[model samples]
Target: MDNMFRLMGSEEFSDRRRCIWVNGPVIIGAGPSGLATAACLHEQGVPFVVLERADCIASLWQRRTYDRIKLHLPKNVCQLPKMPFPENYPEYPTKRQFIDYLESYANRFDISPQFNECVQSARYDEVSGLWRIKTTTTSSIAGSEMEYICRWLVVATGENAERVVPEIDGLTTKFEGEVIHSCEYKSGEKYRGKSVLVVGCGNSGMEVSLDLANHNANPSMVVRSSVHVLPREIFGKATFEISMMLMKWLPLWLVDKLLLILAWLILGNLTKYGVKRPNMGPMELKVVTGKTPVLDIGAIEKIKSGDVDVVPGIKRFYRNHVEFVDGQRLNLDAVVLATGYRSNVPSWLQENDLFSKNGFPKSAFPNAWKGKSGLYAAGFTRKGLAGASADAVDIAQDIGNVWREDSKIHKMRSRVVYRRCISLA
Candidate 1:
C-alpha cells in the first residue's frame, strides 16, 4: 500500500491533491462484481486497486437490502468467478451467507479495497493517456482528498448503485405514515398487526408483503402495471436453471411459451387477484428491457389467501389513508416502496460515449463489457451475477494481454539500459 500511494509534489496538481499511482486498473466498488473482477485479475497476475465508498464490501447487500433478501438465483449461478459457495449453504443463500461468501472471496484473492473512499469524479486524461479519479475519504482518518491515476478503469459498481423512489401525489405532505424505500427495510417485525402499503410488485414488493403477512401485518400491495410472476421452481427443478438450459436448444419465443405454460400450471390464473400478465414473455421482456420477473416463493399464496390485499396504483394519499386510481380508498399505517434501485454511474464517471444517460452500457448485452479508452464495466449485465462473472473473466484476460506485452517491452528496455551503463563504465 505504501509503495503504491506516495504523495506527489503540490505543483503536479491543480488543487494540490494527493496522488496514488495504480500499476493496473482501478476498480470502483467492492461489491461482488468488483471482487469477482479483482479475483480474475489476480489469477492473471495483475495488480489492481479497489475503491469503495462504503466501509465494508458489497455495501448494497451489507446495508441497503432488506433482511429477508436471498439470492434470487441458485448458488451456482450467483457464485463469483473463482469461488463457489460453501457446501453447507442452501440453494438460495440468505443475505448474510452471501456477504460471508463475498468476504471469503476477497480474502482468497487478497483483494483489500480502500473503503469509505467515495469517488467524486473520474475522467480520462487524454494528455497522460490515463484515468484521473478524484475521491474523498470518509473514515476515522477522514477528510483526505486523493486522486488515483491508472492505466485502466473498471466500473464494477454494478446496476443497483442507488435506490429509486417514485414521486406520488400527496404521499409526503398529506400521508401521515412512515415512508421508506425497500432498501431501508429490514424486516416486518415492528409493523405487526399494523396496516402497511407496499408499492411496486417486483420481487422485493412481493417478498416484503409476504413477510408483513407472516408477521401479522395487514399488507396491501400496489400492483399498478402488468407483471410476470413465475414459480421459482417447476417439478423439483429451478426455473432459472431450466431457462438457461433450454435457451441453448430452443428459440427464445418457444422457451417463453413453455415456461409460461409451466407457470400457469403451477400458479394458475393470477388475473383474478389483479396481477396482469405482460404481452411480452418474461425472458423476452427481461432481454428487451432490464425488467426481471418475480420468482414466487411464498408471496403468491399470501396474495391468494386474502392476507395481502392487491391494490391498484395510488391516486393520492390522505392523512392516514390512500386513494387508489380505481376510486377505492384504504387506510394504512406505513408505506414500503419496493420500487427497486438504479445505476449511479452517470453521477460520477465523466465518460459520455461508453455509458448512456441512464447509467448503463450503451451497447447491448454480450457486447457491453468493454468501452473506449481503457474503460470496462462489470455487473451492468441485467443477466445478474453469472453475467458479472463472465465480464470479470473477459476483462482480466483483455487487460492481462496488454499488461504482459508492456512488461516484456519494459524488461527489454531495462536490459538495454544496463548494457549501456556497463559499457560506459
Candidate 2:
C-alpha cells in the first residue's frame, strides 16, 4: 500500500547513493501533522517514513489555501484520528473539501508520503543513536539526493513554515501595486475591479477581505492591533461548539467571562465597525497569546456591509498611497499580506536548546510533543486538527515505547552473539 503514494518510476527513486534505512519514525511534513503521524505509525506496527515537502498530501490544504478556504473549525472539531470527514462533508470543509479529506486520509492509512521530498538537513547522530535525514529530490531525473537513517525524528513541519512578511516601511520601495503574501493568494480573480489592501486582521486577514468583497474587489482591512473576532455561528451551534462547551464547564476566568458575554451578545459593537476589541478574552487570547480568534466566516458581514474596508495600521508606502497609523491615506491597488505564519524551526535545528526564543517548542501544550533529543514536535499544537490528532496519539505511544525497548535490546544482543559464537567454536 505504501508505494510511497505511488507514481515512482525514475528507475524508482533513481538511487542517489541509496541509503534509506528506516527502522521506524522519520515523518517531517506530509501535512495534517504528517498524516497524523502516518496514521499513528500505521497503527503501531511502526516502520514509518513520511517526508513530503509538497507535491501532494495537503500541501497546506493543497497548494497554500484560499479560493475561499473554509474549515474554520468544525467537521466535528476537525477529525483525523480514526479518519472521519466524509459523511456528506460540510460542517465547514472547503479548501477542496480539506484537500479531499487529505487524499482520503492518505488512502485510508496506506500512507505513502515521499512526495516532493524536501527535508534538506536534519542532523542528530551523537554516535549513531540515529537521525541523519538530509533529503532533496526534484522527484528524480537531473535532481536527486536522499539519506535517512531514522529510528525517530517526527517534526511534522506544522507552523506554516514561513510567510509572515511584515516589515512595512514602504514594503520594499513604496507599493506600486500587487505585493501579495496571504501565501500568494488565490481567487479575487485577478482582483476584478481592483483596490485590494488586506494586510492583517487575522484569519487570513478576515478571509482575504471577504474574498475581495465577493470578487468585485475594493476590499480594505488592516486593523493591525487588538483582535479576537470569532463568530462562525453563535446560538445555532459552532462558535467552536460554544467554545468547547465553555471550555468544558467553565473556569478559566469563567471561560473568559462566558465567552466575553457571548462575544458581546453576538458580535455587536465591533467598535462600531472599525473593529478594535482586544482587552484579552477570546478564550484569554487563545490562552495567553497563541492568538487566533478571528473565525467570523462571513468576515463580519463583509465588515458591516460596506463591502469590507477597515484600515488602521500601516504608516508608510507611497508612490500611490498607504499612510494610515490612523492619519489616513489610501490609493492602494493591491497589498494582501494577511500577515501570518512563522516556525521554520530554526531552519533544521542545530539544537539551540530545543527552541523558544519565540521559535516555539520549549514544551508547553500537551508537552509540545516531546522534543529534547530524539525530537518529536508534530503539528506544533496550535490546536489545529485537534492539536494534530493529539500529537498523533502521543507520538504513536512514544514511538511504541521506543520500539519495545529497541526490541529488547535486539534480543539481548542476539543472545550475547550466541554465547560469543560458542566460545569461538
Clashing pairs in 1: none
* Cα lDDT over the full model 2: 0.79
What are the per-residue Cα lDDT tens digits for candidate 2 across 94-208? 8887888888888988998888888777877664456677778877788777878665788888888778886889767877877878878888888988888888888888888
Residue range with the least summed lDDT across 10 consecutive positions in model 2: 1-10
- Over the stretch 1-425, how does candidate 1's per-residue lDDT look in tens digits? 23223323324564543777888999999998899999999999999999999999999999988788899999998988878899999999999999999989999999999998999999987756778899999985538889998989999998999899899999988999899999888999999999999999999999999999999999999999999999999998899999989999999999999999999999999999999999999999998998999999999999899999999988999999999998989988999999988999999999998899999999987889999899999989898999999999999999999999989998999999999999999
lDDT of each: 0.92, 0.79
TM-score per model over all chains: 0.96, 0.39
Candidate 2, residue 394: Cα displacement in angstroms equals 1.3
TM-score of model 2 vs. true structure: 0.39
